[model samples]
Target: MIIYLLLAIIIGYLVFVAIRIGLHQRLPLALGPISLELIPDRAAKKYRERPIFTIDIPCHWEIEALKTRYIDPLAWSAKRIQSTAGMLASLLQHQFNLQYGERVAIFKQNHFDIHLFTISIIRAGGIACPVNGKLSINDFDPYLANLSATILITDSAAILKFLQSGIDFGCCRKLIIAEKRALKSEIEVTALEEQMARSYPDIQIYWLEEALLSVQKESPAVPRGKDDPLYLVHSSGTTGFPKAVILKNGPQAHAVRGWLCYVHLSRTWDKGFGALPNNHQAVILSFNSLLLLGFPAHWSSSYDHLDFNAEEVMRALADGKFTGYFGFPVTYTQLKEVPAEKYDLSAMRIWGSTADASHEVIQRKFVSIGNAFKAFGIPLKGSIFLDAQGSSEVGTPSVIRYFTRYTNTFDRRIGRIGSTPFGPKIRIVKENGEKVKRGEVGKLEVKGKTVFAGYWNNPALTYQAIHGNWFFTGDVVRLNKDGHLIQLDRLVDVIHTSDGEVYSLPIEEKLHKHPAVFDVCVYAHQQPDGTYLPSVAAALKVKNSISNSLLLHEFNQMLEGKEKLCRCEIMEWSEFPIGVTGKTLKRVFRNRSEQMMK
Candidate 1:
């Protein structure tokens, strides 16, 4: 009897050890041929059960993870994300036949699957091509054809739209539908599936859930050189068709390291939040930064595919111990309407803005909201607003500034040029490549490892973009007496009036300071007499009693010389031509303004 009891005790002890080992097992992640085992940080053990990333979808939105799979898809722990992405990578490699150097086009909305799928693609040795999911079928068809991607990963809305449009699948032989719910439409999922199968009879169709459930051992990561293309990110296409920008393997690592040098990382306990569009370069790079730093972040989707509610964003930020909030300037413009007293924003340490330089008025409002630092263990009541001036071509921020509540500055100064070990070097030069004097606006050119490899499949255009070692940023800027770079305007958006060249941004900045103005777009509009003149379209605050004539007079008073506004149109925010990344499409607006004259 004693021997039997001892044997039972030994077996139980062995079982306990096995369970502990399984619990503490590290997950493997592959970047190129370099395999990295995600070792659990001892200090981060306290946060093991805590959510490292969250996706807060509105109740109205029908997402598969929210409706079917998980009870709480909000809390995606690090282990879960790593393990799932590893599995998905295996599925892509073995099941989907995704080979090294092949492009996997992600044409989905702002869903949680996007992050997983992107990571999986990297692990599987495929080039990730994230397209703007909000584009119409007519607009997106040619882009897919150009990429020649082997796999197309999208959601239900895309499938429904494709069926209606009857566009070919390009070179995409395999389709993986991540979500089954047809958002903003009455089409049934089954009907759409049938239609997709019928339309593309030769192509393979796979559901994301099936891929997730299937078991496959992780494949060996394919080797990649430093110059090998990592991902293909696209330009905003405000100028023309979206050009794919090739982001290479090694330079991206250097770029991330460069970002870490200046950008303040979040503390272990401090959660960050963002509502920026998933496909934007800002979001892609920032998310990568968060993962590398092991910082917790919650990314809320822009439900309407346009913009998120300011109240909802603030509510999410306030509910948790959040330290950061990030979005486009348009979201910040709307956030200005949300009163400070409505939410507890004291926990916020960093309010980050990118995609475009944020307005001074909007920056000041956010800077006054959260704490910059604690005063003797007591939380202070003001935050640091970080405005990072960059674009897809730059790949990383060229200039950055941290605006604290203590500093009351003027003008639309973006920041001083940033520096890192292998970062970008900026120079303001004339049309003939002559260096400009201080306070003289010239074309901005950048030279460094931080610039994107080149525009994909467009050798001629790529050659045109680069001059010697420098890449033209297509922006006009000047250096102030204080050695700060003040952004003037986009080269294309510069108003060539009868008097002289007028910058749109400075005038837009001036208009944004007014109490009644909510949003403003300043551009060169062709008048009836066939001359270009500085014009303005602005949206006013709710219940604003000011008339358009009165506001126009006030705005013009703030401007001087050639920059004076000739035409002012007060329109709803929705009426303005907005780009996918929430940038005001000035050229499109120029065409519309001309049409309005007729």
Candidate 2:
């Protein structure tokens, strides 16, 4: 009996250590080369056991950790940083007056700015509706009408523009302006405040700074439960008018917990750096992950500044000793054009590119960094690369892949698609809802903890998008025999020419390879004869002027015998319009092509 007791104690100790190692340390380490055995059939059973939550905002120096470890060594107190939560609590207490249980519409310049207010509104038991700042005045008015916002908080210029455009304020009873030095003199701030005081005596106009300092932080009130609607984010509006996607704190909290597991982040260092805009997933990942997980973050204000000079960024990384960095393909492509040794990037441990990157080009760039550059004939040392795959709708990241070897063939295998550690199921289904055979292309659907509830206030569209808990991603993809997902193309962007031949994303990828091409968009345009012709539009950053005819000749040489494209297809060149989200507005190019042909 004594011997049996001792043996049982030893077995229990071993099991505890195994669980700790698997959950916190070893899981993220094996993410790059994970196997089926590593993730068992009962993978999601743990998620069903209990609820875990965390929230952080690095700018405000707020940190909240639950069921995890945060890797910050600075030991900075939460009081030292500006508190976004505090700002919102003040707005609700003294300045703004919304009727009982009224919805507030927040139209800020970017995602991070809006988050400062949105989170507070949700905490105060009010609904938040965030509008995309990139939309034109015409597109924004209808949304405002639909939401019937009682208060409008925005920059001074936006207020003036709305008034000048003849928008009836109707139910909008208050306007609070967050003044910037650049616009302070141009727009008479005092005059506007005085005018609002007189014209609409009941309407209030308050400055952001004064309001924040005057009001004291109140104890958080009992908010609606996790299942109640907290906030709504507008979609990209690629297919048609944008729809608002509603989200609850419960689903978002669970999704974040799953991401923590998927990234294997407990033991990983918490340093987030990225150049992408706040309106996209780049900001969501960098801000949310850092804040919730107790990580430090460094951010740049503009994407263009980061894309032009990677050497400056590398030098900063060396100075700050950042362990992680994230950016788009353009940023990395620009880095490849420079001599990597000139910049001290030894401090970087993990680097990722979220936007589309050609596997061969990216690998070649890495090789040039770690090996010999033919132009300079100087050898360089390469760094490890981390890659992520997800969209804005999910609100959480999935499908992470890492590469250690500087091989060109890396893109041929899983260039982007990998599995989530949270046990979310990925499936490829044909238009008719049948599962495609292995290696066959079809629409991608994700059934996971991270998927959002649905488009906010647009029940008809929501019903169409989410069928029985599966979110139709609308992206064409395929699965290999090894179960790795491969993204093919966007179903909406596929072009069908008058000749009945189908041209797809490969042509666009090939066009982007040219050094002169900064960006490219391919779509179908109606010809003078009323027949749809496959057309390609490109934006050139290079200074050397190349004529349309010369471009056509080069394109024909590249796709001479390719079945997907015809030699006589039309091509146009213009500057690309970048949105606040740091995404190229491909729809703008499509609209331009339609107008030009007409």
Top candidate by TM-score: 1
| Predicted structure 1: clash tally | 2
Question: Which residue pairs clash in candidate 1?
Answer: 370-382, 370-383
Question: Any runs in candidate 2 off by more than 4 Å, and if so which?
Answer: 1-84, 97-102, 111-113, 168-171, 180-187, 194-203, 221-224, 262-270, 304-315, 328-339, 355-381, 404-418, 498-503, 527-533, 560-574, 596-598
Candidate 1, residues 280-379, lDDT tens digits: the string is 7767776665665556787888733255788877887788858888787878877888887888877778888887758888888888887656622445
Per-model C-alpha RMSD: 10.4, 9.0
Q: Candidate 1 — worst ten consecutive residues by lDDT sum?
A: 23-32
> What residue runs in model 1 are displaced by over 4 Å at the alpha carbon?
1-50, 58-72, 180-187, 303-307, 375-381, 419-422, 595-598
Clashing pairs in 2: 56-291, 244-456, 245-456, 246-456, 370-380, 370-381, 370-382
Separately for all candidates shown, the number of backbone clashes (residues 3 or more apart, or on different chains) is 2, 7
Tens-digit lDDT track of model 2 for 260-319: 564422333435566655545335434443344444555553344223466776676667
Provide TM-scores for the models: 0.87, 0.75
> Would you give me the overall lDDT of model 2?
0.54
lDDT (C-alpha, whole model) for all candidates: 0.73, 0.54
